[model samples]
Target: MTEETGRTVKPGRSDSRPHEDLKLQLPSERRIHTQQPMSVTAMSRRLPQLVRRAFALAWRVDRTSTVLLLLLQALSGGLGAVALIATTATIGLVATGRIADHFGQALPSLTVLGLATGLRALAGVAITGLSERLAPRIGREGELTLLEAATSAELAAYDTPGYNDKWDAADRGADVSKELIGDAQNLISSAVSLLAAASVLTVLHPLLLPFLVAASVPSGLAAVRSARVHYLGMLATLEDRRLLGLLRWFLVDKTTADQVRSDTVADFLIGRYRQAGARIDRTTDEAAWRSARITLTGALAGGLASLTVWAVLVWLLTSGRMGIAAAGTAVIGLRAAATGLQGIVGFGARLYRLGLYLDDWAEFVELAGGHRIDRGTVRPEGPEQVEVRDVSYTYPGADRPALDGVSLRLARGEIVALIGENGSGKTTLMKCLAALNLPHGGEVLWDGVPTRALDARAAWRRTAVVPQEFARWPLTARDNIQLGQSLRGGDEAVLRAAALCGADEVIGGLRSGLDTLLAREWWGGVELSSGQWQRIAVARALHREAGLLVLDEPTSDLDARVEHRIFHSLRAPARDRAIILVTHNLINAAVADRIVVMREGRIVQTGSYTQLTAEPGLFRELWLLQRDRGRLPVQRTTTDG
Candidate 1:
């Protein structure tokens, strides 16, 4: 068990305690698939396709930059070849002792060499500038595309474990776009350099080509093996990494700052963070050792290959098959070739490794794109009548349903209260009514037509919801309320809504009133209490001017006086709008025109508060419980009204 926010958490139910799961061993059944790393052959086979896809994406982002980058790389390669030829000529000319005769040839060779060097340097500079300009655009485009897919997907998509795993993978993958672009640049440069070296070496001697290949083989194999090991290790610890990140946030963020210190769980949290860090350290160490062993073996093989190549070059010179000047040129060519080969091999390995993440990004985008919510073309005005017809919804991978075969109707100009215990489907039902979640087995009809037939965005515009977990936007109080009615500009309406929810008082007390920033982390910003934030959320919802207003525990944090004022103000809106209020506070529900009592996943009773109090049901039992606890006023009983 763990202690958090002065509450005890039981085993297997650590949701209440932030980062508690980081300290516990996850069950085997809960683990995601632990697959083996791809072999070198598999990675090689897929590299070309992945490279093509990545290049296509980059090209689409900025054509001019892509073309310029390729041109620069190609020009640099041409300069490298010219420099090698000039070096060979200079070496051959210098071999002759007579300065007067050789001066003509050597001077021109030196001039050509200088020109090649200068051009290559200029190209390199241009490449760097272009890469810097292009990388951010590529990253932004990729991230925005991924965001579009994520935001357009149905709400139910987030409930599945598979979707969540893919989403995380995609988020990480989005970062790879910038890295992949840089890798592609390296890859092009290296490929061009390798080709230039190979061409120059072949001109010197055909036998030198094999030596260059031999030199690159061992290191290339080593890099591939290392990449696989590292990638697999990271994949194995992905969940741990996520937990570690969360633990770090909990330790540092303002949201958990008070609870962590007040509850005195800082030491416990830090211990868990260290443990997670240690696990990652162990995994990394093991992978590094494995890679080191493979690299050591490859180094030995490469050394032997290099020795054989040098021996053959010596034999060629000693046997008079090659002149001293030619031998010198051969040596220079060999060194350049080896360097070029190493660059190509190293870049190839990096690209292949990064390709896996890029593939994940691609797959996630495709999957999410396919599952986009098709908000139909039919625009919906404020719905006068909404009906839930035998609706049922079960979360992904869960055996039990969150909402069973339940049906209800809501009409404009009436206040309907839904009261139930925790996990009694109150929240789920409210989400369905708001058109956020589609029922699995039935339909939600707006104006006697299925909601699926209406434009989702348009339908959502007609509804306002104060969710149980309302977002505390870190903007000015005025901006927060304005966000609800973004299509309109009504400073008067904003103030009126704030007044209705008693949020006007909260704003007036602020250092800058409506203009004050809500985030404490920012300059001249201040954080409000939970109750104050709830009032702001209420004002935001009320400002929407939505015909259907769904409030799920909207007053859960308000004091008695504030709660009374808010509930009383809700009555004025109820005259033209349909209000569905879900709360545990029975006193608030008492004023509702009609109360619907729910138990488990089903609505067990429906009647006015007075009618429910006189009956023997869950509603009566709950009211008596609150009354005995002195939470409900004794004077406001069924006997009075």
Candidate 2:
């Protein structure tokens, strides 16, 4: 049993909290194949692909920047090598004679050294500028690709196990895509420097280059291990971090702030936040300790190897196997090579970690996170009628179906009301009709063609929905109604729709009238009451000029007067379109030409309201219950009067 939700979580399923639970489980844990560190061979194979992917993205984003960055890195490395050789020549000139006598002879070497160093610095600056320019474009491209994949996927993808988790990982990958440019640049620079310096060392002596590589091996291993540890640890605790963020938002955001205080859940929520955070902290601390120990051991081994290399250099000089000038140059060459090796190891490790994330992004985009919409190419015109045929749907992680062999028919020029208790699949059936949820066992057809045969977006363009939780857009009152699309009649059409839903009265009172911003949080904005927002939501739906309209408890937040006005007016314009209304209010269902009563995912009753009231069934039972309750206020008022 957990202290947060007081629910008993099964063993081996520690992170299996329900989606509706305030305390979220780690979806990423279920998504990942393993938490183990990647093998060296695996990283070696993956790095080349990631590097190619990064450069490809950079080239596509800005070809000029990509070319300049490559040129600058190459130039910088070559200049550094030249500078080292020039320094050695100057040293030999000074060593072979008195400082005063060699001054004139050394001037040329000194000039070469100065010029090489100056040019390398300039190249470094140019590389930094180009990298900065390319990074943001790469990030933006990554984000656009992610959005395209996510938005194009089926709606059911969000309900599938590991799908949401994969999306979250991909989102993080997109955010860090900007770092790829820097990592790629560093890898290129390091490789060039290491190659150039090692060549110089080999010319000085055959044995010197091998010893330098030997010295760098241990540290390289350590850096890779540390990076792997950090990345795996982060992946393990991804959900806990998300949970903490959710709790903080609940505590601080204005929407939930009042509830948190009124319900006195601040202490409980804070406790959960701390507990989730502590879990992440423990994982992070363990990883840090392990990485530190590995790094320390590597450092000690590297130090010993470095000592051996220096001792060998000393012996070569003392025995006259190498000249003093060559030995001095060897020392500088070894240091430069070692620095390059260290940079290679460190940046390579970081790049490997980043590559893992980019892999997530790339994989998600390629496969559409396992939920790509693959419907047919048929483009739907305005649906004259929609029919459901033995449709059944079972949501992810559920045993029972939400809609079990449900069948219904809706035609133009009529209003169909779906009346049922909560969880009776009314909303599911409505979504099926809208082509939003493709059935698993049957089909929903528009104009006698299966919805799957119609292009999903084109089919949806003919739907106008005002759901129970309607959007309170933070835009001008006119835009709220128009929803970024202009009708043939333009402003006149918008006003007519608003007038139909009684929103014109609400708009008339705003400080800027139709131009007023609807969000109170912004400057020159005003907030509307719940009733007023419902009016706008209805108006927005009415303005769409769609053939099919679905209203799920549209009047739930409206006043009695507005609700009456909406219900009374629905049938007038519905003559030319099909309207589906889902409401618990029996009085509202009276306006529908047909009332479909659902129970336990099946249609139990179907008839006009007057016919259903005369028959004895769930509809009549609910009608009596509400009818008695409706008369109670009138009865009380009569007695009091």
Candidate 3:
């Protein structure tokens, strides 16, 4: 069924459009909807577990600092209680009519108060120092853990939207590890203070304790409500935020600057940016208004509760049930109790909100770790014959398969060329052969054993690929080539590889030769032309010196002379290693021992270039088209015999 976004909806109704805000909600929305505005009882039940988890994580980061921070916060709260008691004692002593006699008694209370204040200040400093020491370590540990998971995950996981969403959410939550520690500490501090205040109120009178609790409830509820609104709003707008970020990058990034100007797309992109911004603003404003309403209502209710508490205190005083000194202490206790209660409630709400993101991080970590690609125990030295047996593979969410019933065999010391139109399954077949991707149906075999049954890492170690879209690494020319064989250091082999690909000529022309950095943004660094970069990429692939080499459109950016030279160089290496070359240029394919032509995810013809061109087929038609366009030159070959 088609949705309002003009996308054909799947079984789960996943929306493909980036701009369709209401078309789909984040997966988290389902959980939120099931439990909207979580109750205080639920929060109370979960708080202990969350606090323990946070402490354990913090402890893992720095046990000494975590213990010290907790001790300091507890001490600070204890001092606050001591200071309150001392204040009450001083107030009682000052109530005495004989100032000279009572001065000595008041002096001890005053001294105790000063000591408590000083100790509390020291605790604050100690707590701050410990927190600063621990937070960064915790954040670093959390980020590293997530990064490890991301890098180690199965390559196919990256193709799914579910994985991407979870990854994005986890990336945002990485900092929450530090935040959770901070929140846990705040929760502990606030709870301790609240207990101290409650004890003071209880000492004043048992009735005052209930009155204080009643007065704090509404504000706590308000905090919970506000936190829920904010978090849910963020969940709803996550995709929009991502889109806005991408648009901003397109508008400002140096890599896209030329394209933006050449295509005159700045105004169109800006309009989209403004639209996304406006949508975000509307969502935030709606949340703010909802929160404001809840807050105002809570304030009104809390004010009434406070007035009732005061009225009760006044009645007690007027009826001679409470002494003036006790009444004054109770009034002071009430104010302190209210402040402590608010602190506890506010921190609790914040901790609960942050805990949700932490859960996402935890879930993503488990998912990444659990779904690892099975690198089997069997390890092979090298394959003499790599065979694809009825392989078929489809991308995630794709209706049609990228490769279907494709079978081929690659032998050592032979050059095989793959040629096809775009989306013709050539690259997919090559990826399967390289062990970068495993087929959904059937199997690829190394020698006589299936590749999946052999160790994937070991199998991949024997292969090297220069993809169509090769990475332009921001490093020195030497380092860029050396990265292909990182386990081995740069030496004569790297230089030889560079020379063989004609990249040495490009490097020789540079100011510092091989030492010259490829990034233009860095000091004393220079950029290379597209063709020059392509040569570097070719050099990098050649540096691997693997048993099998796959080159995909490797000469697309090179001049005719350089292209011919690279192809000629490959022929010498073909004596020992298997070579798979994919290209559109018919002349390049003509050099290969075998040429395979694919159409619509299946190989249609497999023969020598001359044999395929002699008959009327896709290859002949393509050759004739190239000849007519003056892209192909006539050359005599021994295949005519």
Task: Name the best candidate (by lDDT).
Answer: 2
Clashes by residue pair, model 2: none
User: Which tens-of-lDDT digit does each residue in 17-122 have in candidate 3?
Assistant: 3443422346655466436657688678778888998888888988888888887888888998898888788878888667687999899998998999899888
Please, what is the TM-score per model? Answer: 0.89, 0.93, 0.89
Each model's total of backbone clashes: 0, 0, 0
What TM-score number comes out for model 2? 0.93
Residue pairs of candidate 1 with colliding backbone atoms:
none
* Candidate 1 lDDT over residue span 166-252, tens digit each: 676678878878777777787778778778878887887788788768777887888888887877777767777887878899998
Model 2, range 1-641, lDDT digits (tens) per residue?
Answer: 77887887766665565535543444554445456456556666777787788899999899999989988998998998998899899999999989999999999999999999999998999999999999999999999999999998998888887787788889999999999989989988988899889988898899898888889889988888888888888887888887887889999987788899999999999999999889999999999999999999999999999999999999999999999899888888888898899888888888999988887898789878888899988888768989999999999888799999999989998899999988999998988899888999899999999999989988888999988888888899999999888988988898888888899999999998899999887665899998899999999999997899999999998889988999999977797789999999898999999999999899999999999999999999999998786556554565675
lDDT of 1 at 5: 55
Kindly report which residue stretches of model 2 are placed more than 4 angstroms away from their true locations once superposed: 1-32, 35-37, 522-524, 630-641
lDDT of each: 0.83, 0.89, 0.83
- Candidate 1 TM-score, true structure as reference: 0.89
